[model samples]
Target: MSAATLLRDVFGFDGYRPGQQEIVEAVTTGKNTLAIMPTGGGKSLCFQLPALVRDGVTVVISPLIALMRDQVRGLKEAGVVAGALTSGNTEEETDEVWRNLENGTLKLLYMAPERLASNGAQRMLRQAGVSMIAVDEAHCVSQWGHDFRPDYLRIGDLRRDLDVPLAAFTATADEETRIEIVEKLFDGHAPTIFLQGFDRPNIHLAFAAKDGPRAQIINFANARKEQAGIVYCGTRAKTESLAKALRDARHSACHYHGGMDADDRRNVERRFQQEDGLIVCATIAFGMGIDKPDIRWVAHADLPKSIESYYQEIGRAGRDGAPAETLTLFGPDDIRYRRQQIDEGLAPPERRAADHGRLNALLGLAEALHCRRQNLLSYFGEDPAPCGNCDLCDKPADVFDGTTPVRMALSAALRTEERFGAGHLIDILLGNMTEKVAQRSHDQLPTFGVGKEYSRVQWQAIFRQIMGHDLMRPNAERHGALRMTPKARPILRDEATIDLRRDTIKSAKSGPKIKQMVSEEDAPLLSALKAKRRAFAEQLGGPAYIVFNDKTLIEMAEKRPKSLDDMARIGGVGTKKLDSYGAAFLAVINGEAAAQHPQRQKLAGRNDGSIYDRLLETQATLSRGPSGTDKPMSCSASQLAKVASQKPRDEAAITRLLGDRAADRFGAAFLDILRDA
Candidate 1:
C-alpha cells in the first residue's frame, strides 16, 4: 500500500527517476498538478504511481484510442489493474470494466476525451468512485497547441462535476498552451507546476539541406546499418517509396501510414515493436502510441508542420537516455508546400496568422546558428545552455555579412512591383536572360544587376536568410511572392546591417570520406569479433549487424573484456545478447591478448607517465556515458602511435572513445568499473 511497495511490486523500477518522486508525492497529497516532461521522461508514472496509492479508481483521459490501449497494456504488463472504455470494446467488455470499477478491482481506467461527451459514458463516470482525473496529451485542450483536439475542451466540466483533484501532463507546450491548459483543464485553479527542461542532450541533432533526400537517407542508414530508427515523411506516398528504397538497399524496413488497411498497419506496428533494428518509414500516424523506447535515431526526410510537431517527433529517440542521432533533410519545396497548405486552410485570419508564426518558428529552428537543442527549448520558454551534443555546437557555423546583397534583393522585389517569387527575383538579381525578364523589360531596372556582386546561389542564400529573419514575408496568395514587412523598411532605410550564414554548397568535385581503418593492434581483435558476429547472424538467418552492430563490435575490441561478465559490460551487449555471444567475443579478445606485446621493447626506453595519465583520463571520461562523457584526448591515436607502439598505448587511443551505446548496453552501474580504474 506504501509508495515504496507499489514501486517495487507493480512498476518494478527500484527507485523513482528525478522529479517522479516529487510529482507522485504532490498528486498523492490531492493537489492539482501540471507536469511537463519531455517524451519518454516517465510522465505516466507521475500519474500511475499516484493512482495506485489513491483510494478510488483514477480516470485517465487520453487523446488517442491507440495511446489508451497501449498504456493499459503496459500497466497490465507491469501487473497493475487497468482497463479502457472505447468504441472498439464489445458490450461484454464494457460490462466487465464497469463491474471491476464497482467492485474496486480496477485501480485505473483509461478513456478518450470524446467519451466524456457521450450520455452513457457520463452516467458511468457520475456513478463511479473517481478519485482523480489525469489528462494525458493535456496540451490538446489548448487551441494554441499544435495537436489541439476540440473534445478536450469538455474536460474542464468533468473536474467540477466529479469534484476531484486533477493532474494534466504533456511532453511539449509553448507558453500559450501552458496558460490555456491551466485555464481550460483546471478552471483557472492554479496547480503545482513542473516544467522539466526540454533538452534531450543525448541526441545528436544534424540538419542537411540537399536534393535527392531519399539517397541521403539511404546513405545515413547505411552507416547505421541495422539500428532501430524511424524515417518520417510528410506524405504517405513518400513513406512507402522511402521504405521500398531502404529495402532495396538491404535494410529491414516497412512503411506505415493512415492510408494503409487496418490489418496491414497492425502488422507493421507489430514488426516494429517486436523486432530490433527494423526501420519504419511512416507518416505521423506511426509514433503517437508506440512505447518502444530504444529507437536509436529519427530522421525527417521533409519538414514537419510546426516546431511543436518537430519537438514531439524527435522526442521519440533516445528514450532510455542513451546516445542517439537525428538527421533532418529539408529543402525549399518543403517550405513552399507547407505555406500553400496554411494559405489554403479554412481557419480565421487570426488563427492563420498564428499558424504562420508557428511555421516561422520551425524555420528558425532549421536555420538557427546556436545550439539546436537550446533554440528548441527557448521556443518552449525554457532557456537551456548550449548543449555541446548537437552538430551546430560541436562544429561552429561560418557566418557571412549579407547587408548589401539582402538590400539589393529586397530592392529588386520592390522595383519589380513585389509581384514575383524567389525564382523570378533570383533571375533579375543574377541578370538572367529569361523570356519573362526580356518581355517585362526587367533587365533594364536599376537594381537588376546590383546583386551581381554575389553569385546566383549566394543571392538565393541571402533571400532565405532574409525570410528567416522575418524582415520579409512570402505572399502566399500570389504563389509565394516576395513582400517586404515593416521590419524590412528600417533595413532598406539603412538602420541595420543583416548578417547571414554562408552557404555550404556541396561540391560536385568532392568525393566521400573513406571509412577509416582501426589500428593494427585492434585489427586482429576487430576481425575476430566481426567473424563471430557474422557466424551468429548466419545461425540466426538475419543481418550481421542485427546481432550486434559495428559500433558494438568496435567497443568490444577496444575494451577487451576478460570474462563473460566483462563482455556483458561492453556497449550494446544486452542480457539476451551476452548469454548468446559473450563467450565467443571474449575468446577473440583473449586470443588477441595472447598474440600482443607489439610495443614491449620501446616501452622499456621511455618514461612517458604523462601520456599514460592522459590515456587513463580519456578512458575515464568516455566511460561516463554521452551527455556527461568528457571530451577525449584532443589528439589522434595515430599521433600517439608514433610515440609508443606496448600493447600500443595508442591501442588505448584506438579505443574509439566508447559512446553512450556502451553505457546503454551495459547499464550505468558498469560505468563504475571504468571510473574506479
Candidate 2:
C-alpha cells in the first residue's frame, strides 16, 4: 500500500504535518534520513507510515523501553502489526512478537537502543528480514547532548551490519549535536536531513521569578485544576514535597525521581499514561520516555540544567497540538544551583563550559525582554517572527540599561579580588555595615556604596540578571565566590552595555498585606495603565500584567508621580529600566524627574558571570612570554567573543573559530578555563 493510503486506512490520518510528508517520502523511498522535528510534530507517523509502505519489517531503535512499548501498543491499536522486544515485556508478549516475526505478519518491530548490544537481538532482526532502521530520539547518539545514551552509539554499528537504509528522528539537536549524530550514525556520510521548524505555537511559555515559589506552584496547579500536567523539580526531595503540596491542594498528584524504586517509578509512569488529570511532580528522570500527548501544562519548579534539556522537557507538554501552558519559576537560587551542578559534574572543562553556556542561554530566556518563542527558536538557529502565544507576548517586561549598576557589581567583585560571594559584595555596594563587611574591610573599597539606588532585594535581582548575562560566575573551588568573566570586563571598562528587567529587579515584599492589585479609587487609572501595558506588551509580545502588574500601575496611578524619580519611589518602580515603559507611564501621570531614592542597594549576588573571563584569561596567559606560542598567539576580542557567545562544546568548532595557530597554543588551555568557569 502507498504511504498515503496507509495513513488513512491504518493510522486514520488524512494527511501529513508540515514537515512530515518529505521525511515520509524519503524514508519510504529507502533513503538514509535524519529528521529533527519538534515534539508533537507527528514524528511517529513519518516512520510508521513509511514502514507499512516499505517491504518487510521495519526495525525501530527507540531509546526507552516505555517509549518503545507505547509506540508498539499504539501501532497495534491502529490494526498494524507491531510489537516491542524489551525487558518490560512479559514472556507471552515476547512470544507473540517472535510468533509475528515467524509468521511474517509484523509490519514494525520496536526495540530499545540497548537491544543493539546483544548479538542475538541483531541476529533476530537480521533473520526477520529487517529492511529499514528507524532510530527515534536520534540525538542520543551524540555525546554533546544532554541525553547521551551510550547504547545509541551501537546503532550505527548495527546499521552498517544490517546494511539497511537508516532513518533517525529527534526533537532537539543543535548544530554540534547534529554533526556528532551524522558522524556517529551515518559514518560521516550526509543523510537526507529534514531540519523541521522548532516552533510549538500551542505551548504558552511563561516564566516568573521565584517569589513564594511554593505558593506560586500551588496557585498555578489550582488554576489548571483537573487538567493533566507535569511539574519538574530540581531535587528528588523537592519533587516529593511539591507533589504533596499539590495533593494537599486537593489535586491528584504524585512524585517521581531517579532515586525512587524502579518499580515505583514504573508504576507512576503507567499511571500518568493511563489516567487523565494526573499531575506528576518529577525530577528530570520522569520525562523522555513519557508518550502522553494530551498533557495540558508543564511547570518547572526549578531551572533546568541546559537549554536543550529545557526545550526537551517543555516539549513534552502540548504534544497533542491543543493549547498547553508552561510556567518555569526561576530565581537566584535556581541559577546558582544549576551552575553548581554543572561545575560539580565529572565532565572535563570544555564540556562543563559548554554546559554553563547552555545554562546561560536558558537564563537569558528566563530573563527575556521580548517574545520567549523568538529567543527560544533562535537558540536552534531558526529565526522567525515573534509568537503571540507566550506570557511575554501577553505582557512585556520593564527593562533598563543596567550597565551602570552591573558595572558597580562587577567593580565590587573585581575590587574585592573576586574572593567573596554576592552577600559581602552586596554589602559593599549598599554601604551596609555588616560584620563580614567590616571583617573583610569591604567598606573601605572605592566601589563601596556605589549602587545606592536599589534596595538589597533589588540589588540581588541585578546580580541575578548579571549572572543571566553570563558576565560573572561562581568559583566552585573558591567556595562559590563571585568572580568577573571576560564578558563583564568590557562592560566594566565602559565599552559595552546590557539591559536588565526592571520588574524582576524590583520585587514585592514577602509579608502578607493587601490582596487586591489596585485601590478602588485608582481603578480607572489602573485600567488606563493596563491599556498602556497592553499596548507595550503587544509591542514586546509579553503578557500585559507581567510587564507592569495592576499593583505597580495602581501605585503609579495613586501616587500620580510627577517625575521618573517620583515614580521610582512607587512600590515596583525602583531598579534599572533600559527598555522601560516607566518613561511612558511617567508621561501618564506627567511625573517630573521622578520619585526620591528609597535607600541604598543591598542584599545578594550571583556567580555565573565569571566563566567566560577565565577562558579569556587562559588565552591571555598563553599569549604572554610564550615560547610555545603560535604565530597569532592570541585570539582577537571579537574572536574570543565568538568563543564566549557560541560556546564551542568541542575542540573542532573552537579550532575552526580560532584557526590553527591560535588553536594549537590556546585550544586545550581555553577548554580548561571553560571547565572551571
Candidate 3:
C-alpha cells in the first residue's frame, strides 16, 4: 500500500504532520535519516509508517521498556502486529514474541539498546532478517544530550553489522547532540537530516519569577479546573510537597518520581491515562513516552535542567491541537544550583562547558526581554517572529535605564577583588552589616553603600539581570562568585550605557479570584460526592482519582442530572458507568429534587422501568473468567452505582453512555438481550 493509504488504514490520521512525509519517504527509499521533530510533532509515525511499507522487519531500538510497551499496545490497538521484548515479560511472553519474529508474524520489534549490547541478542538480530534499525530517543547517543545513556554508544557497532539503512529520531537535540549522533550512530557519515520547526503555537508560554510558586500553581489549576495536566519540579521532595499542597487546596493532584516503586509509577501512569482533571506533580521521570492527548497545561514548579528538557516537558500539553497553557517559575537560586550541578558533573571539561552553556540558554529564556517563545525557538536555529502568544508579546515590558545600578554592581564586584559572589557583592553594594561583610572589612571599600540608593532586593534583581545579560559570569569553582566579564568593563568604565527592562513582577493579586460562585446548598452535594469517591477508591484499593475525579463530581453537582440520560451527559460519565451507578446518584439527585421542588416528585416515578438487569448481565459477561475480576475495567462499580442512581436507561443508552469499551464488548449482544426482555 502507498504511504497515504497506510497512514489512513493503520494509524487513522488523514495526513502526515509537518516533516513526517519527508522522513517517511527518505526511509522508504532506503536512505539513512536523522529526524529531529518537536515533542507532539508526530515523530513516531515517521518511522512506524515506513516500517509498514518497507520489505524487511524494522527493528526499533528504544530506551525505556515502558515506552516500548506503550507503543506496542497502541500499535496492537490500531490492528497492527507489533511486539516488544523487555525484562517485564515472562519466559512464555518472550518466547511468543521471538516465535512471531522468527515466523515473520510481527512487522516491528522494539527492544532496549541494553538488550542489543548483548552478543547473543546481536546474533539473534542478524538471524531475524532485520531490514532497518529505528532508534528512538537518538539523542541518548550524544553525551551532550540532557539524558545520555552510555549503552547507546554501542549502537554504532550494530549499525555496521546490520548494513541496513538506519533511522534515528528524537524530540529534542542541540547542535552538540546532532554532531554526536552522526559520529557515533552513523559511523561518522552524515544522514539525511530533517529539523522541523520547534514552535508549538497551541501552548501559551509564560514565566513567573519565583514568589509563592505553590500559590501560583494552585491559582492556575483553579482557573483551569477539570483539565488533565502535569506539574514538573526539580526535586522529588518538591514534587511530593507541591502535590500535597495542591491536594490540600482541593485539587485532585498526585505525585510521581523515580524514587517511587515501579507499581506506584504504573498506578500513576494509569490514572494519568484514564482519568480527566488529574494534575500529576512529578519529576521529569513521569512524562518520557506518555500518549494522553487531552492534557490542557504543564507547569514548572522549579527550573528544568535544559532548554531541550523544558521543551519536551511543555510539549506534552495541547497535543490535541487545542490551546493550552504553560507556566515556568524560576528564581536566581535555580541558576546557581544548575551551574553547580554542571560544574560538579563527571562530563569532560569541554562537555561540562557545553552543558553550562546549555543551562545559560535556559536562564536566558527565563530572563529574556523579548517573547520567551521567540528566544526559545531562536536557540534551535529557527527564527520565528515575535509570537503574540507568549507573555512578553501579550504584554510588552517597560524598559528602564539601568546605567547607574549596572555600573555600581559591576564596580562592586571588581572592588571586592572580584572574588565575592552575588550575595556578598550585593551586601557590599547595599552596605549590609552581615558577619561576612564585617570580616571582609572590604565592606570598607569605596563602593560599599554606593548602591544603598537601591534596596537590597532591587540590587539582587539587577545582579540577576546583569548575569542574564552575559556582562558578568558566576565562577562555579568559587561557589557562584559574581565576577565582571569584559562586557562589564566598558560599562563600569563609563564608556557604555546599559539599558535594562524594569523587571515585571506579576502582582500576587492579579490571578483570578476564587469566590463561592456556586450556591451554599450545592457545597454540601459537592462534599458528599467527593466522600463517595473516596469511599469507592478505598474499597477498590486504588487512588481516589481512579474511582471518579473531583471534576466529574463537581460537574455532577452543578448539573444535578435528574435522569440516566442526563447523568451520562455529565462530562466523565460513560455508558457502563451510567448503567452501574446512574441510578444511585440519580436517587440522591431526586431526593434533593423532591426536597427542593415538590412538583418534580411525580416525574421521578415516570421513568421507573427496570433497565438494571440487562446492565448487570453485560457487566457479568464482560467480567467473565480469566480476564480477572480483580483487574477492574476502566469503569468501576461505584462509578456505575453513581450512574444507575442518577439515571435509569435502556441498553441503547447504556452502550452509548459507556463509551467505546462498552460499545465494543457488549453493544450488539446487550442490545439483543434488551430486545428479548
Candidate 4:
C-alpha cells in the first residue's frame, strides 16, 4: 500500500499532522532523516508510516521498554503487525515475535538501545532482513543531550553493519543537540532534517516562587482532583514524602524514582497507564517513557534540572490536543541546588558552561515578564505572538524600573572584585554588620547600606533576575561566586535600565486568587498575614502553613483580633498559635511592621495608615503656615494617625485630637483631603 493508504487502513488517521508527511516521505524513500518535532506533535507517525510503506520489517530502537511495549500494543490494536523484543516481555510474547520475524509477518520490530551493543542482536537484525532503522528518542545518541544513552552511540555501527538507511526522531534537540545527533548517528553526513515549531499552545505555562510549596501543590492537586497528572520532583525522598502528603490530602498518589525497586517502579508505571486520575510523584526517571496521552496536568514540585528537561517533561501533558496546565515552583535554594548539581558533574568546562546557559534559560522562564509561551518558544528559535494562556499573559506582571537596584547590585559585585556570593553582596548593600563584612571591611564600602529599601529576600530575587538576564553568572571554580558578564557593563555604567516583575517576589501562589480567603477589604491584611507566615516558614525551613494555614490567616485578617485571648477564639488557632503567633499578629493588626518603628507600623495596610503619612507631609509643608514665616509646629505620629482615622469633620473635632495651634494650622487642608477620601 502507498503511505497515504497505509496511514488510513492501518493507523486509522485521516491525514498526517503538519510537517509529518514530508518526514514520512523522506524516511519511506530511504533518505536518511532526522526529525525534531515537539513531543505531542506525533513524532511516532513520521517513522511508523514510513516503516509500513517500506519493504521488510523496520527495527525501531526506543529508549524504554514501557514506551516500546505501549507503542507495540497500540500498533497491534490498529491491525498493524508489530512486536517488541525486551526483557519486559513474557517468554510466550518473545516466541510470538520470533515467529512473526521468521515468517516475515512482522512489519515492525521494537528493541531497546542496549540490545544494539550485542553482536548477537546485530547479527539477528542482519539475518532477519531488516530493511530500515528507525531510532526513536534519537537525541539520546548525543552525549550532550540531557537523556543521553551510551548504547545509542553504537547505532551508527548498527547502521553500518546492516548497510541500511536510518531515520532518527527526537522531541528535545536544540541546535547543539541537533548537531551532535547528526555527527553521531549519520557520521557527519547531513540527513533530511525536519525542525518543526516547538510551540505548545494548548499547554498553559505558569511559575511561582516557592512559599508553602507543599500547600501550593496540595491546593493545585485538590483543585483538579479527578484528573490524571504528574508531579516531577528533584529528589527521590521528596517524591516519597510528597506522595504521602498527597495521600493524606485524600488523592490517589504514588511515588516513582530510580531508587525504587524494579517491580515497584513497573507496578507504578502499569497503574499510571491503566488507572485514570492517578498522580505519579516522581523524579525525571518517570515521564520519559510514559505514553499516556490524557495526562491533564504536570507540575514541577522543584525546578527541573534544565530547560530542555523541563520542556520534555511538561510536554507529557495535553498530548491529546486538549488544554493542559503546568506550574513550576522555584526559589533561591533551588537555584543554588541546580548550580551545585552542574558544578559537581564531571562534564568538561565547555559543556558545563553550556549546561549553565541551559539553566539560565530556565531561570529566565521562571522569572519571565511576558507571555510564558513566548519566552519558551523564543528559546527554541520561534518568534510567536503573545499567547494569552500563561499566568503572565492572563495578568501581566507588575513591573517596575529596576535599573537602580540592578546597578546597585552590579556595583557591589564589582567593588568586591567579583569575589562574593549573593549573601555577602546583599550584606554589603544592606550595610549589615556581619563578621565577614567587619573582617573584610566591606561595610566601609560606598555601596554599603544603599539597598536597605529592600529586604534580603527581595535582594536575592534581584540577584536571581540578574542571572536570568545573563548579565551575571555563578563561577563554578570559585564555589558559586558571582561574576559579571559584558551584558551587565552598560547597566552598571548607568547606560541601560531593566524592568523586573514586582508580583513574583511577593509569593508563589500569587497567581489566580485563591477562593474565599477573605473579603475585598480584608485581602490586604490577609496578604500581610501570609507574608508573616512565609517569614516564619523561611526561618524554620518549612512550608508556610507550618505556622498557620490560609483559613487561620483569613480569620486573623477578618477578625482583626485585639489580643491573645481573641486570637485563641479563632478556628485553627489553639494554645500553640496563641502563644507563638498571637503577639506578632496582634502587632500586625495594631498596624505594626516587622522592623519598622512603632509609629510607622500603624501605617501598614490601613487607609488611615496612608492618610496618617499624608497628614504628616501636609503638616510638614504647612508647618510654617505654608510660607516658612510663621512659627514651626507639628503633630506626633500617633496624633496624625488618630486625626486621619477619626477624620474630624471640623476645626472643633480636629482641635480635640491635635492641640488648637497644630490643629488650626493643618485642619483646613486635612479636612479637604479627608472629606474627599
Candidate 5:
C-alpha cells in the first residue's frame, strides 16, 4: 500500500503534520535518519507508518517500559499489529507477541533497550526478519543527557550486527546531545538529519513569580475544569502534596514519581491514559512517551532543571493541535535549589558550569520581553516571526532600564567578596541592619545601603535578573553564596547595560490570562461534547481523546455538525471512531440527546464549571441590587469568572473590572467570598 493510502485508511490522518512527511519518507526509503521532532510532534508515526511500507518487522528500542506499552497499544488500536516485549508483560502477553512476530503478522516489535543486553536477543532479532530499527528518545543514548540509560549503548552494536538501517528520534537534544546520539547510535556515521521547528504555537506560554504557589496552581486548574493537564514539580514529595492539594480543590488529580512502587506508577500512568480531565502531578519521572493527544494545559509547580526539560514538559500539551495553555512558577529559592543540585552532582566542574548556563537560559526565557515562542524557537535554532500566542506576545511585559540597579547589586556582591547570597546581599544593599549583616561586618562596606533607593524585594529581583543574564551565579562551594562571574565585570565597569522587566522586579501580578480555544457562544456546546466524550470513554474503557480529541470536539462544537457524515469530516474522527462515536457526539451537538454523564451533569448551565459556581451564584444574587433595591446591574460571564479566579481583595480591585455601580452592589459580597476562599 502507498504511504498515503496507509495514512488515510489505517492511521486516519488526511495529511501529515508539519515535518512528519520528510522523516517518514526518509525512513521508508531505507535511509538512516535522525528526527528531532518536539514532544507530541507525531514522532511515533514517522517510524510506525514507515514500518507499514517496509517488508518485515521493525524493531523499536525504547527506554521506558511504559512508553513501549503505550505506543504498542496505540498502534494496535489504530489497526496496526504492534506488540511490546517488556519485563512487565505477563506470560500470555509475551506468548501472543512472540506468536505475532514469528508469524510475521506484527509490523513493529517494541522492546526496552535493556533487552538488547541479553545473549539471545540479537540472534532473535536477526532471525525475526527485522528490516529496520527505530530508536525512540535517542538522547537517552548520550551520557550528557538528563535521562541517560547505559543499555542504550548496545543499540549501535545491534545496528551493526543486524546490518539494518536505523531511525533515531528525540524531542530534546542540544548540539552536544545530538553529537552523542550520532556517535553512539549511528556509530560515528551521519544520518539524514531533520531538526524540525520546535515551536508548539498552539501552547500559550506563560510564567509567574512564585507567590502563594499552591493557590496559584489550584486557580489555574480551576479555570480549566474537566480538562486533562499535567503539573511538573521538582521534588517527589512535592508531587504528592500538590496532587493532594489539587484533589482537595475538587480536581481529579493523582501523583507519580520515581520513588513510587513500579505497580503504583504504572497504575497512575494507566489512569492518566484512560481517564479524561485527570490531572497528573508528577516529578520529571513521568511523561516520557505518553500518547494522550488531548491534554488541554500544563503547569509547572516548580522550576524545571533546564530549558530542554521545560520545553519537553510543556510540549506534552496541545499535542492534537488544539489550543492549549502553560504556566510556570519560579522563585529565588528554586534558583538556589537548582544551582545546588548541579554543583553537588558528580559531574566535572566544567560540566557543572555548563549545566548552570543551561539553567540560566531557562531563567532568561522566564524573564523574556518580546515573545516566548520566538524565544523558545531561537534556542532550537529557528527564527520564526513572533507568535502572538505566548503571554509576552499577547500582553507585552512591563520593562524598565535596570542597568543602574543591576550594577548596584553586582557592586554589592563584589564588595562583599562574593560570599553572600541574595538574602544577605539584599540586607546589605537595603541597609536592613540585620544581625547577620553586622556579624559579618558587611554594614561597614562602601556599597552598604547604596541600593537603598530600591526596596529589598526590588534588590532581590535585580540580583535574580543579574543571574538570569548569567552575569553572576551562586557559588556552590560557599554554601549558597552569590558570586560574580566575569560577565558581571563589564556591567560593573559600565561597559554594558541591561533592561529588565519591571513587573518581575515588583513580583508578578498574577498568571497571564490565556486565550480560549473556542468562542463564548460555543462554550456550552463544547461542554456538551465533552460530556458525550466522557460517556464514550467510560463505556469504552479508554481516554476520551482516544475516541475523539479536543480538536475534533471543538470543531464539533463550533460547526454544530448534525450527522455522521459531518462528524466524520472532523480532523481526528477516523472510520472506526466515526462508526462508533459519531452519531452520539452529533446528537450532543444537535441537542438531540441530553445524556450528560453524571460528572458533566453537575456542571451543566454553570459558567466556568463548578469550582467557580459559588462565585457565579454570588454575582447572580447581587445582579439586581443589595436587596433588590435598584436598577439591574451585572458583570459579564467572563468577568465573573475572572473575579472568581483572581479573587480580588477590595472594592477598588472589583471596581477596576466592574463599573462603580456594579462594584458598589456586589463588591462587599465578592470580597467576603474572596477572603473566605
Candidate 6:
C-alpha cells in the first residue's frame, strides 16, 4: 500500500502531476491539510491515494452528488474500491454501499454535506472506522465563498467526533474566504496548507462585450461542432432558450437548471459525462462537481456574479491538460443586472458593497488591457510571465484616452443631481430633446450638448467603463440612479486620466471565424476517430473520453497508429484502455470502416438525422409562429423526441403525430425534411 505502488499499479501512472505528490505525502502522513489546487490539477488523487495507503475508510464530504458518483465510478474503473451514498442512488445501490462499509471492503466513502443532517451520520462514521475526513469543494464551508453550503459547517463537528485528521480541497479561495474556511473547518487551528499554483495555462481565455449574444454563442458553438462544451447562463429561463437555440443549430444540446426535477438534472449530468460532443446549457447549478475531463470548451452567455465564480466556471474546460477554449460574453445590461442582484440581496451594507467590489474586479478582468491570465492570476496573488493563451495576449485591445468623455459623463450625472440612470444621463449629455428631457428641462443644463462629439452609443460605452472602473455606482435605493463614488472625484476634477478599450464601445463585432482543430486534410481522419470513440462510449455506457479523449483522437489522426504498440504509446491510452479498445480504434485509423453504435447507425444516412432535427429546429424557430404573430406553441419534449426516434414517413402520419393546428404551422417544413431524408 505504498503511494508509489498505488500510483503505478492501481492508477496506472508513473509519477504524480505537479503539486500532487507533496499533498499526497502530507495527507498520507496523517497531517491536517488544506490543498488549494487549481481545477484539473489532480486534487482528487491527493486524497484518493492517501485513502489507499491509510488504515481505514476515508469519508469524503462532497458538495454535489454527481461529483461524488463520478469519482466513485472513476475510482472503480481504476481498480479502487469507492462508493457514494447519494440521493441519486437506488435502494439497492445504497444497500450495496452499506454492505461494503460494514464488511470493511470499501476504502473511500463519499457523501453529500446535506447527509450530515442525519442523526446517525456521526455514529455511522464512528462505527464504520472512518480514518480521515476529506472535504471536496471545501470553500463551500465559508459563507463568503461563492457557493456557500450551510451543511458544510458540520464537517468540523464530524472531524472532532471522529478524531481524525482532515484535508480540504478547493479551486478558488481569496484571503477572506481562506480565513473563513480555517475558522469554520479547523476552529482557527492551523493546518498543513499547500497553496498550489492557480494557473490553468491549458485553458485559452477570451472575453467579449456582448454583441448579439445569442448569435455570438451560436457562432462559437458551430465552429466547434461536435465538441463537448458547457454554456453557463444567469437564469433558468436563459438556460432553456439558449439550449433550444443550440439544439436548433443541429447540435446535441440540453439544458440544466435548479428548477428542473432532480432526475432531469441528473440525466443531463449523466449525458454530458457519457456522450461525446454534448453541450450542456446550464446555470451555476451544474458545474461544481462535474468531473468530466475532456470538455473542449466553455462559454458564458451572460456575466457571472463574481470573479471567483468566473474563475471556477472557466476552470471546467481543458481539464485534462489538453488545449481547451473558453469565451465569456458580458454587456452593460449584465453589469446592471449583477449590481441590482447584489444590492437587492438581504446581505448587510458592507457585505453588499464588498460584493459590488468583487463584481468590479471581474469587470476589470473582462475589460482588461493586458494579458488576461496576468490580470486574473494577479488577483489570486500569482505573478507569471505573459501567457500567450489569452485573447488579450493574442490581440491587444485598442485603448484610447477616454478621460474627456468620462469626465463629461460624470459632470452630466453630477449636474443632474445624480438622480438619473445611464439612459437619461446619456440623453442629457447628447442634447437629445426627448419627452423626458424636455419635461425635466435637462436641456437647460450647461452639461447638455457638451458631449455631442460622441454619439449616444459612444456616451453609453463611456458610462459603462466609468461604472466598470468603480468611479460611479448605481444606488439601488434610488432605483438604480447613477452616483459618483470617491474614485470619480479624482477624474472629474481634471486631476486623473483614464483609458478605455475602443473595442468595448464597438462590442464584439464578429471576429475571425473559429479555426478548426485539425487541417482540412486530417479532418476526415479525426471524424473517423470520433466516430469510433462514440461507438465505444455508447457500448460501454460511459463518456467518450472513457474510451479516449479528443486529445488522444487528434494524436491518433496525426500519428495514424498502425499497430497496438503504437496506439499504446499515445497519451491517455493506458494499459486498461489499450487492452479494451486499442485494436478497434487502430482498425479505424488503418482505413477499415468501424462499426457504428446502433443509435448512430439509425441516423447515419438519414439526411444527417435532418428530418427530425430540422423539425425540432423549425418548431423551435417558429415556436411563437411566423413573425411571432400567434400564441407561443411548440412540440413537447416527448413529441420532439418521438419524431426524432420514429421519423414518420408521410404528411398524414406526421399530422397524426402532431395535431392539425400544430401541423399547419410546421407541417410543410417537416414534410420537406422528410422528403429530403
Q: Which candidate wins on lDDT?
A: 4
* Candidate 4 lDDT: 0.84
TM-score of model 4 (CA atoms): 0.72
Please give the RMSD to the true structure for each candidate, in Å.
Answer: 29.5, 21.1, 26.7, 22.1, 26.2, 23.0
* Candidate 2 per-residue lDDT over residues 1-677, each given as its tens digit: 77778888987888877978888899999999999999878888889888898889999988777677777778878898999888778899999999999999998999888878888998888899999999998988887788888999998898898899999999999999999999999999999999988999899999987778999999998899789999999899999999998888899999998787767888998899999899999988777778788999999998888888888889999887899999999876576556655654545446756776677788888988899999899999988898999988899889888888988999898888887677778889999888778887877899888888888778877877787778876653343366677888789888998888988777733334435454423433454455557777778888877677667876776677655445556776545541265567765445233432122111001122234456656766777536744444666766766665566767898899999877877888777766655
Each model's lDDT: 0.75, 0.79, 0.77, 0.84, 0.81, 0.82
lDDT digits (tens) for residues 516-562 of candidate 1: 34432354346556666776787999999888998888887666676
Compared with the true structure, the alpha-carbon lDDT of candidate 1 equals: 0.75
What is the C-alpha lDDT profile of model 4 across 36-141, one tens digit per residue? 9998999888888888888898999998876887799889999888999998788999999999999999999999999887889988999899999999999898
Count of clashing residue pairs in every prediction:
2, 43, 28, 1, 0, 0
Q: Which stretches of candidate 4 lie over 4 Å from their true place?
A: 439-441, 506-677
lDDT tens digits, residue span 275-345, model 3: 88999999988887688888999999889988899999999999888999999998755665576566545
Give the CA lDDT, 0 to 100, for residue 523 in model 3.
45
Error of 2 at 570 (Å): 53
Better of 1 and 5 by lDDT: 5
* Candidate 6 lDDT for residue 89: 92
lDDT of 6 by residue, 113-209 (tens): 9999998887889899999999999999877767788999999988888899999999999889899888999989989999988999999999987
Residue pair clashes in candidate 6: none
Model 6 misplaced stretches (Cα beyond 4 Å):
411-449, 475-489, 492-495, 506-677
From the highest lDDT down, the ranking of the candidates is 4, 6, 5, 2, 3, 1
The TM-score measured for candidate 5 stands at 0.70
